[model samples]
Target: MADHVRTVLGPVAPDALGRTSIHEHLLTLLDHVAYTPVETPEGRELGEQPVSLATRWYVRQQWVGVRDNLRLDSEAVATAEVARFRAAGGGAIADPTTDGIARDPAALARISRATGVHVVMGAGYYVHRSHPEWLEAASEEEIAERIVRDLQEGAAGTPVRAGFIGEVGCSWPMTDRERKSLRAAGRAQRATGAPLMVHPGRHPDAPAEIVRELDAVGADLSRTTIAHTERTLPSPAAIVELARTGVRPSIDCFGLETAYYPLAPFVRMPNDGGRLAIVEALLDAGLGERTLIAQDICQKHRLTAYGGHGYDHLIRDIPVMLEAAGRGDAVEQLLVANPAAWLAW
Candidate 1:
């Protein structure tokens, strides 16, 4: 079959996917780790506190601990939120909420239908911690079969088939099962001829290590992407090094400007200017075609419904920033052409 972008609605032409976000979560539950006890003030249960203006500061600081800030369960809310993206001329979204992260393929389909935005769902396991206990006993072949099924058939018992093979989660000091998951993703990609994306651990070496893991399985590096490069690959040099492997490095943390990353305090997230600087570095290296970017709006606080920049932030805001930096011509390549080429398997 010719290369086409598989969407929840069905197969679409590559050029049809205009202004796409390569990584996002339309609906998910992080309660697997969010509700865990954290250091709170004097026996106060901060994890259970609902999201509000009063609690937004704490939620921003310790988002993983706040229950309300971690969940995106409302279909109505997702539809409304995505409507903003449609209004801003967004044509597609790749929601890579795979296994271990409460992926609702049915809900994604509904949101796509309501908003008229093409949504490409992901298939595979997430981080080792978010992984199910049954995964420990599962072999790579078994995992690969499941992923293949999701791509060719349907996901989560729904008729909505996954269009891609990841945001496959890997942690720093990759667990045995996580390594197995990467191998499984590689096999699944080989089987289905689908594009793959990976959520690398929060370490500098994590992206390169994952490159080795996938390469060992004979997967197509050019068809694979290393997601969250903004947080994983610290320096522009590190980002360039990973891109040399023929794997697209996705800097998918656009609107998240806080320097203190709650999950990894040691890692200082760059502001928008810093993100553009990295973009310049990639362009300078003649790797702009190999680069991808998104907002990666997984947290509830990152949604416009909750005082956060909606899906439109990238399309609506960033073009002007690029223009100010005298790189306005690259916007089409980054937001439309690159993603369309990558997503079209």
Candidate 2:
């Protein structure tokens, strides 16, 4: 039998995954990894304020520290947002919410059922800091076994099986546990024939270092993605270099336009225009097939309910921009074909 794209609901044909957002988080509780230090008066002020019209602008600027902005846990809000995405022509979403962060398989199933969009849940741990304390002592085999179980059976005690083996977390100066997680992700992908996604560290060198780790485990590099390429790699040339390694380079944070990245202050996050430019550059480099894009909307501030672009930014605005640049043909490739190919098992 042909391989299928496993989703929260069940198996879907790869081609059935329509204009897909390659990376997203319908529900997230990243405050554990992103809460602001309430030491100074300014810090305390930002920490306490809820995400609102008055706070949204500043929250966008200083996204990481604000506790309210880091969370995106509303199932009702997610359904509404995803419904808008479907109305705007989105057909599927790849949500790599795994361990560490809050991965709600039950909520994802409900969202998919409500909106009729394919929801691809991820399996594996996140950053070392967000990982469950007991995970530190788990062997690589144990980790891979859990990932495989999530893929083959059900995730988080629900019947929603994971479609992929990542957004596997790796940080700059990678920890031993993170390395073990990468190897386990590789093993899971090998066992189940699912694609692997990775959230690389802030360092520019992180993507390549991660590729080395995955490569060591004999993972299918072509089926692996080094996500957050726009933030993690310095320039289009650097991203192209990583793409040459046979792993897809995903510019997953499309709607986020901020110079001040609170997570990695030194690294400059690209605006939408700059992100499109990177996409064009990838197309120019003949690496279009290896490119993936999404909003990676994990924050409350980025949701339309909170006055941000919501899930349809890629579908609503990006094609117009790409067409204006004379790469009109690239729109379908970016939003539909590329993701479909990458998402397939």
Candidate 3:
């Protein structure tokens, strides 16, 4: 039965999932026009000098390549990325670039074939602001049916359906539209038995609200992951509480702290040690098995430069951090055994 919902790489073998980055993006070209280009006079006036120069150069290049290569060659790029990951002894990645911006499954299959990395795709709407207009009018049951169909059938006409439920439903203050989407997503999780992943809002109260909403809808907390909980300063007690209810807390937004900037470095989680400290605290509190970690690096420009960290960081750095902090065994449990048990693959 799981075959219907699994990717081309069915029942990912233990050996296959060498080191997984469970939440990341394979392709994204966010509406760059929504904000002024970094090079524009208005951007310059705002003192975003570095960004302005970068944006101007990016836009110029995009224009020049508009006719030749407007859209990203996702298959080729993903294949190459997977090759690099494999070379680094990495195994699997979950491309949580759900609807609106996610690339085609055919592309995913191509990359999987070329590079031998297990690629898990996602199904569900993005943030409320980015969602398609029709979703505003759709019924919860209708949304659930759509999500179930994607899990049961496949995304983008492939025989392989998506393996998970999100990167879904975000709003700074948990807006009505996002709430509706969350309810629908919960309904989908209930129907498909797929793990529901969330992109929680930036507010501190966001994690509690998300867990509450999912609980209210009869979603299996055990199978749910609150992704990027690292963004908000969630109380250690709050994280433990969620874990007590069987939900997994994830600090999946590694290495891309630059995206959150000034707000992130300051948003420490109640203790003195920063985000990593919080994970340690969660482990100490008896919820280590319910924790997961990843680097949610997205964006074409970032990957095109600097070799992009490749996805082997978890297998490489996690043990070192844990050992340095005197918790080596905990690292093995969290990074390896925990993810396997949670996904039930």
Q: Give per-residue CA lDDT, model 3, range 19-73, as digits (tens).
A: 6677866655444212333355653443322223345444332321221112233
User: Which of 1 and 2 is ahead in lDDT?
Assistant: 2
RMSD of each: 1.4, 1.1, 5.3
The candidates, ranked best first by TM-score, are 2, 1, 3
List model 2 lDDT by residue over 1-345, tens digit each.
787888899998989988999898999999988686546888788778899988777788878768888888789999999999999989999999887799999999999999999999999988988898878889998999999999889987888799898889998889999999889899887777789999999998898898888888878999999989988888988998899999999988998888778788788888989898888889999999999999889999889999999999889899999999999999889998999898887
**lDDT by residue (tens digit), candidate 1, 1-345:** 789999998999999988989988899887775454467662158778787887777777677778778888889989998999999999999999887888888778888999999999999988987887888999999999999999988987888899998889898889899999999999898777799999898899898899888888888999999998988877888888889889999988998877878788888889888899998899989999999999888788888878888889999999999999999999999999999999998
TM-score of each: 0.97, 0.98, 0.82
In order of listing, the candidates' clash counts read: 0, 0, 2
**Global CA lDDT of candidate 3, please?**
0.66
Against the true structure, candidate 3 reaches a TM-score of 0.82
For residue 195, model 1's alpha carbon misses the true position, in angstroms, by 0.9
For candidate 2, which ten residues in a row score worst on lDDT?
Answer: 34-43
Model 1 off-target regions past 4 Å?
Answer: 34-38, 42-44
**TM-score winner:** 2
Candidate 2's C-alpha runs over 4 A off are none
